[model samples]
Target chain A: MKKINIKFWFVGLILVSFLSCSDNETETLFPDAPANRAAQRNAELLDLLLSQPNGFKGVYFTKNDEFGGFTYYLRFNADGTVDMTSDFDTETAVESSSYEVRLGTTTELVFTTRNHIQKVSDPSYQPLIGTGFKGTSVFQYFTNDNGTITLRDIRNRDSGTLVLTPANFSNFETESVASVETSLANRDAFINSTAVTAFPFLSVEAGGNLTEFALNYDGVRLFANPTKFNDDGSIADEEFGIAFTEDGLIISPALDVDGVLINEFTFDGSSGFEYVATKEGVTAKIGYGNAPVTPLDAYAFGVRATAGVFNMDERFKSSTAFNNFYDAFAEFLLNTYSVVVGNVVFWDLNNGGQPYIEFITNAGRFWWDLDFEVTNGIVVFTPTGNTNASAGVTAIFQPLLDAFIGAPSGYYLLNTGTYLNFSNRTYSMINVDDPTMTINYWDFSY
Target chain B: MKKYTYIVFAFMILAFAMACDDGSDAVGESQIDTTPPILNDLDVWLRGNFVSPYNIEILYKWDINDTDIDRFLHPPFESSVRPVAEALQKAWIEPYTQVGGENFIKKIAPRQFTLVGSFNFNPNSPTITLGLAEAGTKITLFNIDFLDFTNINDIKRPLKTVHHEYGHILNQNIPFDVTYGEINPADYTAQWFNRSDAEARELGYITAYGSSQAGEDFVEMVSEMLTNSKEDFDAIVESISDEESKGIIRQKEAMVVDYYKTNFGIDLYELQALTEAATQELVN
Candidate 1:
């Protein structure tokens, strides 16, 4: 009986201790509840977004490698609506739309209605069919400093990073369109004019490293890629989205090279069209040169491998030596076979790693294969093979084909001075034997 | 004494365990948002035009939760919202009210309207979704950005959708005669897009999509009749060559008119005329 009573007392004491332990309070890191904390954070962000009296200069980056960035002037009102204008082609008209700051995985700033900002994300936008810029309107708040806020898009980590900084409202009101016009003019002066015979390249001197970059303008944005071509022959380039200010240009998200940054560039048109980026203690200059700033060997190979044809135009047949030969061939075909030639195309790298020049006619297409090589910044064609041509075609067209092939020195390929990119670019092929025999053909790939 | 000791231990343990809870924790405020949404000028206008009078809510804003997230959909442009909303009022709401009675639309109408800027393109199919209705409570309009008020065709597309979806809403309240589906039961197929609109009409249906199912066929008749002027409708009936198919179509048309009169207390012809006039007013 004494043992039983002792056992009961032991169990009773154990139960009492367990109940007391259950009542013990556990300490929490946050003084407030998680829900309350989230609500508070959302409210703070909403207040901060609405607090900008002068409005915000919003920079939105596209996730895709081909496209880079866009700029917008946004004014957030207390009514959960935002008035927005963008730097996209004569779109200075302000559009008002709704927005909301809500707490999800993180606090988010969502553009609830379609506005100028949504144009970049619109899937039906023609340039980026099925994928419109690959951008997002829902941005998660990342950081907030003095007057600037950084947000990451919620769709994908690399979808975009929207950075908002305070802007002078009055200045944006009057000078927005002026700045766009100036940017267009400056772009034309730099690389897109007929008189621009030289290729304009950028030299960035930062952190004791001087890197020469090839410049590519996609009409809407500008990109500077390092001249180093990869083993696969693709140019690994970094795109910088820039917005033109009244004085110069502002590069959004900044260009960082080896831990050194360059953000703004002032236009210098005294000597030639040059943009000097001296901001962030870095000196970068855009200078012009007759020869390409990048290596020539890989570019020529890539162009031939991808696009095998340089279609000839009337200008190529305008020379006396070429004109007589071309006309005689056409007249012969007309008189003999009643066939009319539509186009004469030179395929530097046709099927089987051979070269062929094709004559597309109303009757049928004819090809005469040739031996070719790319050396000394030019492509030389030797009239050796006529495997693709019929016996009758070879007998009648071989002599004309040989004359059209020009001298053994071949043709010197020069940029037409409008664009340097492979797509939508024009290159003038001047005969090595006769300099007067020059013809320009557009890529038309775009 | 031993039994008394056991009982006392049990009582003591029960007392200790019972004392553990004091019920001091109070219920917190609900995390659900209850505050009224902030209204801008457009929102205010929508409230006055749609909500105050008819109890309908127009959601022009892009809320991913309100749509199918898988489909790449966007909100209608702010500039396009009012034009589309006004057209809906004139063509759909006003005409229905005038014919169906003053309080007709208020009692029997979609409560919510969701406006989307981009067309809802299906990933695997060539067909694009123009509009969708959910349980007769909500109607989602797509491709609002392409609405050209100056073009009568553009005005007809959305108005036809409203009338089509509204037809379903009426049927939900009071269904069409079940015998109506029996008129041409053999023609319905999921692959209705394979047939042309002309072929579907020859098979006693109004449109290619109308031949998909009986419910769609009924709504198609309502939508096509209301959107098409009487002259166009008569011309279509006249064009059909098959006597049996034409008779079936005529039988369905009488049922549609009778459905409206008996169920909703509205003359289908009068409502059709009003809607046509309202649509013409937009282009003029």
Candidate 2:
């Protein structure tokens, strides 16, 4: 068996002086001072006592007297509590202890439970010492927004003078408390200053035909439309904008059609003005909110009410948001429908009713006709017509038919008959069966 | 008259002695034979006095040759004989039982078999040096080194080898489900061995050495999962290369998950997480 040896060293020195007289002669030097003078001296004494080190808080490192080399750090809280932890096997042995600070000519720190006391030899100045320091052998005084003091043995060569200095506490405090408020104020300023003079709308800007057009702001674009306007003075578009209202911008298409207020738009300093889109009859609400204006913050919003034709391309940059939307839509399609796509697929809005999807597979092309209607927070999808080869309609295309309805308030349909077309190693959107859709397409090769 | 009487008595005594020595009479009928050595004390000491924490039963057989007594008893002195056996039992049997169980020991029953001086080989499985009977008895010509067991941390080779061979024995007794093969397709090969150690580690397997064969690979996975610390396993995974290693790592991970779910009814990910957390605390 091998024995492990450890060395320990005593730290700090205390010096005391005594007054002595040679002879036992009876001599009294002002045995009783005047009452006024005594009162004055007591006041001075109280001021001096208050100035001495009273309590300590920060980090404390303890070395075993028997097994000298191993050191453990105890984190101390401002309320005079210490966290005692073991070096070996942390699962079963970590514990905490409490202490009290006693102030006097010589500062003393008393461990409440064990009655162990140690005098404070070092006084390090800090800016925000929430509580005063008390005498303790190892005292780490940590200020609220200032710094920290590290206590160590001054005598040992390996462990010399306990260093007391301010840590980078300012950085920690700023991040923990002040940063949130700062971000909110910045966001409010940005929204108030940058106003949308011309809202995005479905127009013939590309080729004199109604298609999805994004209103680019500060190089960031939002998918929206100015398709129709309200008879009232307030402008009604993909988003609503009242000249003077609590909500920065309001966009509700349901107000005219359903005669119900399904969405309410509001903005705060923290999250810039947002439109909360909910169902008329139901309690469910889903919409987008802007992020606080900070260099590090990433903005995101949740889609609460997903119905009919909800376009994800309206959320953020096309490259990132569009791909994510497609992925999500693919997953939703797999979960909802049993139809398979093999060859040519076409979206026909020729009759000017609700648009329908026609696809050609090995079993030949089948048309799944749909009727779009918006009610409350939901975009209800209804099927129309009957076409089958057997005794009756073989399969009802309710799921596919439901996918063409209008989305919630924050979102808008890119185009009435916009089809995500994939054919012959090319991906494109055929809008309104127009040939210009092929010209204004996103080419992956580009 | 007295001389004649004496002659007649002598003659009568000689005739009686001659008559008593009949052809059927036996010579020295009170012959004694030495009693065979009573093994009562030895049995009591082995069974009652010496307790195996692993709960293994002890059986003793006298060697006609007397050559194996010193090797089997180990350390030689009569007082230390039981202690040496106890030490060997703790060093080897205890770890096995703790990791496996009493059922494992039972699976390896009586725990002893005779050793032959002559060399023998299995024709079908030429690589197998030792043979175990269906009754849980093993026969080997050579003795295992107890002192060299200190290299238990060498997870790449020796320690892993012992654990793997033992795994085969256990697997043989209680056959694993065939579903284990579905995790990593049958196309998997030791060609992973051709890869550098760095490349293999990235894939999450313990060592490139494991990619040698499917059988060895399976055993390696079991041994590493059961014995090695999480830090050691993680270090190996972190050291692997980016490109060629992911497939191997994915395969190994799937295999380990399957093994735990199929055999022990424990979540492999949860255990791995716990082991990793414990190891991190130690290092930090």
Candidate 3:
């Protein structure tokens, strides 16, 4: 019995060992090794990225609710390098850096080096300060259809979506970079041009749907006050950020007017400053008109009143009627008291919501409170009282101060034009009674 | 029974051999990359100049893993990397080798250097960090992209950081007298940034940052002395108002000089002179 038991025990041990070392059926579940599959996927994704003959064009929104979207052109090389350019800044200069397509939880495309795309995500980028532009350098494959590849930021999937399409290098060169540069130059010219202070409002008609966008001052934002009230018993204003592309301009968060989607518009100055947008065999022509589709007086002035102080422009100081009045006063002050008049600014929602006008001078800044009303298309100002800080300077230049603060009619807040950038525009404050006594001021909120 | 045992043992061996065979002979190559890194001209120069000689690895490319995640930083441009590296070699390494010993940097120095293009801006603080030395093994220099080689002050800024951080490495190797901290313990404060350099000098410190702690105080003295000419350092010492403060600073300076002599047999003043000369030559 003992001999038989020993033989049985040896046989059982061998059986268990063989069973433990055997490969499981799990190998059949996957046709190829996980490592090899991942490597192949990485190669394919890289090939797809480099397959574009010219390059890839992409649009990215820094923040869903904030400054709209930015356009980027990128060319990927197999040698772990990438060339990138953007429409955000005037430089539009191409930047070269390294990139990698590697497998993580999913296939990821990472900008591994400092480039234009990385700058949007860099907190050290000056414009955004500590928060940056709320962008990301690591992107995961989202979709590939109809020659367009969509990559979503892995870290901030909800922040924005970046869609890439095969781009012709020459088209981007001529239409986007050169076009953006031209638009930028024109933007600067528009701001400084005194000949035409009035900018035309854009009327977009898409799929038989008509919507009007008033080109806000600063030249990049289009504002539309609601004609219909919301369920909350409040009228909401829709605003979109606009930027110049290689061939034309793109309006971020493509507007969904009724059922028609209208976002991108092409502009060719060959037939005047005309813009057109097309989608699914339907075309939308954006025509410019002198009068705003939506009246802007109450909306514009009301927003500016509470936004921040309006800084007086040098144009105001140099205008004939206003300059004649102020230059003599400035000369008198400089010749007699040796105190120079610097500039003047208007502030609302200051001093417990009381409107005030401040006269900045070489000696110091002085302020006098005023009562103002935002009427149909203008503001009427009446100086009420002077503060202790203004008492001394006000005693010397009370007449000049009163003339600026107490014009016959308050200033008509007129939109001069918009810039290629979004959010803010420039406005000229013309004396309602005397257009020559005009002051073109910038919004000092930023 | 012995014959039966032999038969069982033979069968067991046969079973083991069968268990080991999986029937597949195709060994897969390791998908993990074993390839050498692609080196540009700047990288080749760095390897030849710093790596082969001193075992130093200069990282000028942007790698988020190599930096503090909370702070905003970037990699130095290829154009900016070589100039700063050359400056470090001329001003810091060559001078130290000449003054201390030929193998001074090769044996006891940071093995890795990280170059950053932008200033290391702190989110919570108003100040920006120019450089950081980690555990005597690594040194990260910031604002290399902004360095104007023609400007003496800008050139001194990073060189000062190198000397200052290296001072800490030396201190780690052979600590300064513990009594050094007791010299002005009452003056050290966490709120050093609130105090101006003039005020710190009046309180027996070379810089406001030196007033934070004893280790920083020693390093700041090393940095300030090495970066500035002997005349400038003396002028600063003389500018202090209180006679008692001046005496205390003189005492600290004496300990520093003595620390080098008794510990490493190095003339601190000679190293400082060589450093200053190298730095001046660099800008000129």
| TM-score, candidate number 3 | 0.72
Q: Could you give candidate 1's per-residue lDDT for residues A1-446 as a string of tens digits?
A: 97987988788798757867574677778987777788888988888888876578776775534455666778888877788777654656777788999876799998988887887767677755545665666788988988689888776555468888887567655554454455545544444443343345667776677766666445443444435455687776656555554456655456776677877678776765567887555688755544456754323522533233343443431333345456677898899889787776665553355566777778778887677676876777776665666888767766656555655677667655333333454565556655445445554321
Docking class of 3: acceptable
What are the RMSD figures for all models against the true structure?
A: 10.0, 34.2, 8.7
- Superposed by TM-score, candidate 2 places the C-alpha of residue A438 at a distance from the truth, in angstroms, of 97
Regions of candidate 3 where Cα sits further than 4 Å from its true position: A2-24, A27-31, A60-66, A77-81, A93-115, A118-127, A130-157, A160-163, A170-176, A179-231, A235-243, A247-377, A380-446, B1-21, B24-27
Q: Give per-residue CA lDDT, model 2, range A143-169, as digits (tens).
A: 222233333332221322222222223
Give the top-scoring candidate (lDDT). Answer: 1
Angstrom error of the Cα, residue A431, model 2: value is: 99
TM-score of each: 0.69, 0.24, 0.72
DockQ of each: 0.31, 0.01, 0.30
User: Which candidate should be chosen as best, given DockQ against the real structure?
Assistant: 1
lDDT of 3 at A40: 76
Q: How displaced is residue A186 in candidate 3, in Å?
A: 7.8
Score chain A of each prediction against the true chain A by TM-score and list the results.
0.62, 0.23, 0.58
Q: Is candidate 1 or candidate 3 better by lDDT?
A: 1
Error in Å for residue A154 of model 2 = 77
